[model samples]
Target: MSTGSFVSAASVENHGVVCDCGLPSPVRRSWTRRNPDRRFHTCKGRRVENGYIDCGFFRWYNQGDPSGWQFLALLEAREMMEEQRMQIAALTNEVTTLSMNAENDVKSKELGNRCEALKRDVQVLTERCIGLQNVLIASTVGFGAVFGVMMLMWTSNTA
Candidate 1:
């Protein structure tokens, strides 16, 4: 059986086996190409702050390799899991991009509305200024005419 890659077996009962360190070994499963689902015993060690330290004990739980059909099924299952993980990652990226685009679209629309409102305000202010200027010119012309009439009346009384 292959010994390159192994994973911890979940919910596996202990087999009353002890290593050189007098610790009970835990059952694990291999994931290598040669031994896809082979179970074995590995030293159960305490976890330190950095990592786990083991007694370097190892033993095979199963007698022989799995049949041809079983090996093929395990390989196929592993491939399917990898493909699903890749698909999930791609979908997550797509969702994030779409969310950002939606936010930018909303901000653009708000800015456009603000620009239009400012333009309307400027137009209203310009119209009011023009109206005030016309009123000032009319008042100035009326004052000039009143002054000319007063001067004519004064000259006639002096003569």
Candidate 2:
């Protein structure tokens, strides 16, 4: 195809440019080892997995040499930004985990303290119950002794 068939980058509408095959052009990344990061517009037919033909609608969205220092710097900066974003996400997840663990630890300590207090209360109640039982036994024995002495006096007077 002659170069005239391809529209200049500025001449094409940003939203609604179609290829000669009557399909919209999609911006795609170049996977060539030499220019992996370069972007361009092409026909969707080119991406088909079946035995389909390409429309050859080509235009460089990032028009520059992939080997140039400025382009390489831009790519490096993009890679660094992605790495930083991933690090931020990982740190956020770690912070959430640590926060949950700290909260659980505090709750466990409080539960243990409550359990100890309940045990001490139960010990005090048990001591009180034992004291009450001892008092009841002593009173019963004293009453029996007084009743026996009165019965002896009455029988002696009658005899």
Candidate 3:
């Protein structure tokens, strides 16, 4: 008899969990939670019934490996990582919008100031024109007013 040399299916299937040969075989159990079920097979060769022509083997089908827990853990980790990535993207978008709004505000204020300066310059030029016109009208009264013209009528002045 080969001792410690035969390959146990549980080791290869369950990551070295205790083999069911230590327990019984043809196992089927249902518990709470999603109508959860478990099924597996071990190599401790149970006998079949009488009038059976096959060997001393019980074939148990529909038995999945013991990867349910590990797969769940992996799925949870992936979901957490995806949530973190979405948060980062949302934060990045928020930061970009804030920065652009700040820049636009600064530019708008600068343009408003420039427009005010141009308005002030136009007002100053208009006031200067009005003052120059007033000065010319007053000087023309001294040189060619209606009374200075009467003096020129005293012999057509320089004629």
Candidate 4:
């Protein structure tokens, strides 16, 4: 393909390996559905563009046009990649769960702190109410004693 991302370092090993070009033959994978995973060596300058230039240098890396071992290797690589993707998904889920738990803990602690503050306020208000009740009782008794003394003085004068 025109895209070079699939190019392998193994391709460089083919440099001067067996090419009549006496130069490198970069390894390239076939993308056609007919031979979906086949690999081959071709001239480094071969183009799949409008020019479609080729140096007439070609060789199949897979034996007998399609090798059983190469197909197995491709399957193994796909399986390994799938396993890694599953592992990453599991780790991501764990991180999200841990984050939610941490948030819950912080919220719980804040609620407990607010409840404690309210309890202290209630206690202070109760103490002030008791002090006010005591003051009212004392004032009532003083007024009653003053009234009794005034009645005694009126009866003594009337006698």
Candidate 5:
């Protein structure tokens, strides 16, 4: 990646550097491994969408590349950045997994509670059915005893 100020042709006219295509060159910084952060000027012309073409002008804006120690430091910084990015991705995945697990746990608890409530309802209904059956048995027995007594009294009167 390179960084630089976008100087228009008119703005850079005072610098007296112009490309073969009659356009003032723009100053840019290089971020490659060989020239990390070195500044340079290149042609302002760019290739059209139909074909590749440019003035191919190039010039160094800075005098020299960084020292050996400076280059090593840049490499270390790049590696550290990559490691940090990987760590961030791993943490993000863990958070998503934990969130899903928490949601499932809540749902499971709710289902368990609903099951208990249904079981209680069933128990109450069974008890009510047993009570109704007892009442029906008592009613039938009482009716039979009353009818036998009436029949016995009428037969004795007739005799």
Candidate 6:
């Protein structure tokens, strides 16, 4: 068929879909225009044969533009690139989150160790203070007894 009109395509969702003659043709992909983006396909012949259809195959354009296969390849490549970019972004975010969590864990462990060390130091200091208090009390009692004896001896000598 000679290229005349555009080959427009549309998607239809149906549980039971059939061709014009009621023949079953499983859908390929959701549906896409043959060359509606840039060029289209149409029949140049009259609509008489093939059950009032122009030609068995429609005619779009390929004179100035690229072929349909080329356009499809380009579209597929773009889709793959988009998916790859999304994957990379997700992986980067995961790595950053993991690093932050690791750093927090280390800091928490260090704080816990410091708290334990401080508790041990407090225990040691409290024990030392108790020992010093006991020694002070004993020294005071001994001094009082010695002074009492000294006073008694002085009184006796004077008498």
- Show how many residue pairs clash in every candidate, following the order shown: 0, 0, 0, 0, 0, 5
Q: Point out where model 3 deviates above 4 Å.
A: 1-66, 150-159
Worst 10 residues of 3 by lDDT: 28-37
**lDDT ranking of the models:** 1, 5, 2, 4, 6, 3
* lDDT of each residue in 1-159, candidate 2, tens digit only: 233232323324334667778877766555433464566777666445766686777777767757777567766776787799999999999999999999999999999999999999999999998998898888888888888888899999999
lDDT by residue (66-151, candidate 4, tens digit) is 54766667767766877999999999999999999999999999999999999999999999999999988988988888988999
- In candidate 2, which residue ranges exceed 4 Å CA deviation? 1-17, 26-37, 43-65, 150-159
Which candidate model has the greater lDDT, 3 or 6?
6
Model 3 global lDDT (CA atoms, 0 to 1): 0.57
List candidate 5 stretches off by more than 4 Å.
1-25, 29-35, 40-67, 143-159
Stretches of candidate 1 exceeding 4 Å from the true structure: 1-6, 9-12, 32-34, 47-52, 63-67, 148-159
Whose TM-score is higher: candidate 1's or candidate 4's?
1
Point out the higher-scoring one by lDDT: 5 or 6: 5
By summed lDDT, the worst window of 10 consecutive residues in model 1 runs over 2-11
Q: Can you write out model 1's per-residue Cα lDDT over 36-140, one digit (the tens) per residue?
A: 778888777779899988888888888786778878999999889889999999999999999999999999999999999999999999999999899888888
lDDT of each: 0.83, 0.72, 0.57, 0.71, 0.75, 0.59
| Count: clashes, candidate 3 | 0
Model 4 lDDT, full chain set: 0.71
Q: What is the TM-score ranking, best to worst?
A: 1, 2, 5, 4, 6, 3
Say which candidate scores most in lDDT: 1
lDDT for position 103 in model 4? 96
Query: Per the 3 Å backbone cut-off, how many clashing residue pairs does candidate 6 have?
Result: 5
Output the number of the TM-score-best candidate.
Answer: 1
Q: Put down candidate 5 lDDT per residue, 18-46, tens digits, no spaces.
A: 77787777776666656665667777676
- Each prediction's RMSD over C-alphas, in Å, is 3.1, 8.1, 16.8, 7.6, 6.2, 13.6
